[model samples]
Target: MHSDVIKISDKDIKKPKGKVFVVYFSSISNNTHRFMDKLDVSDARIPYELNQELIVDKEYVLITPTYAGGGGDTKGAVPAQVIKFLNNENNRHLCRGVIASGNTNFGDTFAIAGPIISKKLNVPLLYQFELLGTQNDVESIRKILEDFWGEK
Candidate 1:
């Protein structure tokens, strides 16, 4: 079996002032986790358990997988863990933007969580990708974050 691993160079990782970080919630499928692994940046994962505490004190971007299914209603699109994490007043205030992952097969509901959270939090929906995402997605996200944070 051939194993493929992406090695990130130190120079590729931007060390922005004030340390804008990435926070994500991945379900059992772990597709969002796989996507986050491709980016070279500081990140925290929202635990599956609602009782777990995760308080991000600094500005950060949130990456989440959309879970909505059928009829394009967007009900239950955002994971409970993500909702719990964002419900924290501090966390909600510190969030700078959001990136969402979803299967396009869901039509209008694809990546719905991004827009929903963006509106609720008054943050921008930075990006959206399907499933694990491609290399281009990773590069675009890198540039987006660098520009958003005004890399020093």
Candidate 2:
């Protein structure tokens, strides 16, 4: 069976309506942090910082990694800290979408955090990539962000 993934180039990605905030957590392998670096844009912050002040406005995308267990035995779920940060009612409105990361070894549970966040937060699960991601993954993510943030 062929993968149904569509290949999008950097040229295809458009400019944003405004700024796009990338919120991520990198506690374990830090692969998600590495992936964010490849994006090469500066509008990013950690969840802890945002919690200090309720950000009721602005467009943001969550980029987080799935933990081995959801702080316990539930594998492939969003970490507790991330959930706490997002739980703030004010922060919920600012989130436009999500991009999740996980290890492929997790199999079907890989990057499951993205789906949970997207559903609970009422946003789209923009992308889910393996740890650190690949060159194509970076470019594709750029395109998705650009398109999502474009005039609309």
Candidate 3:
């Protein structure tokens, strides 16, 4: 088998209408970078910041590592930061899809980011992947993406 799984709601994972943006916000050295490497990109938030008010008419999937208070719920609630970003965009209709990625331990952290992404932007969580990071993080990621997009 060349597949995997992540629990998601019905609202998430819609086939987007236009071009897609794979936005990644990384802090912990290479985890974020390594993950992004396994995927293809039409465009990326490499600078990880967007032009103010540039409503992306294309679909988007966000992959961000959970940090700050640390893994899942420190009860720290930094998920609001993502909401703030969406609020700043003020273009809910522009987002046709949503996704998040983080270490498997902080499962709830990124999981929480999903609904908030939906509520804040009124979008949907297309899917999310949590990595415990085995001996081969790259291969783990490749398997997951292969499962999701059925590409490479």
Candidate 4:
């Protein structure tokens, strides 16, 4: 681990700065939702739960589960909801980055959704968290957002 990375507890994660949004989709297990809970940002929303207007007014991060490629392969597919949302030309500009979740048991394919999103959407692959995420992962995410937003 880098020296700059701090370990934050669940209760101590800092909220994202500026007009940040976290769009996610949780299917099968609730692990994606559980990971979203670790975020201090209040703009967390599931695609299905959102209204007709899928375009966010500000820059945002997408957190979604890997729907395919769970073996030793590194190629993974994005969730259906996320793909639909991203398919909208209007909504594409709102995305700044992505965080993908997957089981480590998948080996090289674990959290492969991030790369797929990053490549397709032309955005950064910010982080890849294990199922439900760890407290350390949450803290590292907080730090990354802070740095990205130029916040202290």
Q: What is the C-alpha lDDT of each candidate?
A: 0.81, 0.69, 0.49, 0.69
Which regions in candidate 4 have their CA more than 4 angstroms from the true location?
1-17, 49-53, 72-76
- Scored against the true structure, residue 77 in model 2 reaches a CA lDDT of 74
True lDDT of residue 92, candidate 2:
70
What is the number of residue pairs that collide in model 3?
4
Tens digits of lDDT, candidate 4, 60-146 = 778888766655454336766777788777667677777888777777677788877777666767788888888998898877776
lDDT of 1 by residue, 1-152 (tens): 00111233445433334765899999888888888889878899999888897998788899999898846578899899999998899998888788988888888888888888877776767788989999999999988898878874
TM-score of each: 0.86, 0.76, 0.55, 0.77
Instruction: Report the Cα lDDT for residue 21, model 1.
Output: 88
What shift in Å separates residue 14 of candidate 1 from its native position after superposition? 20
Which 10 residues in a row give candidate 3 its minimum summed lDDT?
Answer: 1-10
lDDT of 3 at 108: 44
Q: Please list all clashing residue pairs in model 2, or write none if there are none.
A: none
Considering TM-score, which of the candidate structures 2 and 3 is the better prediction for this target?
A: 2
TM-score order of candidates, top first: 1, 4, 2, 3
Which numbered prediction scores highest in TM-score against the true structure?
1
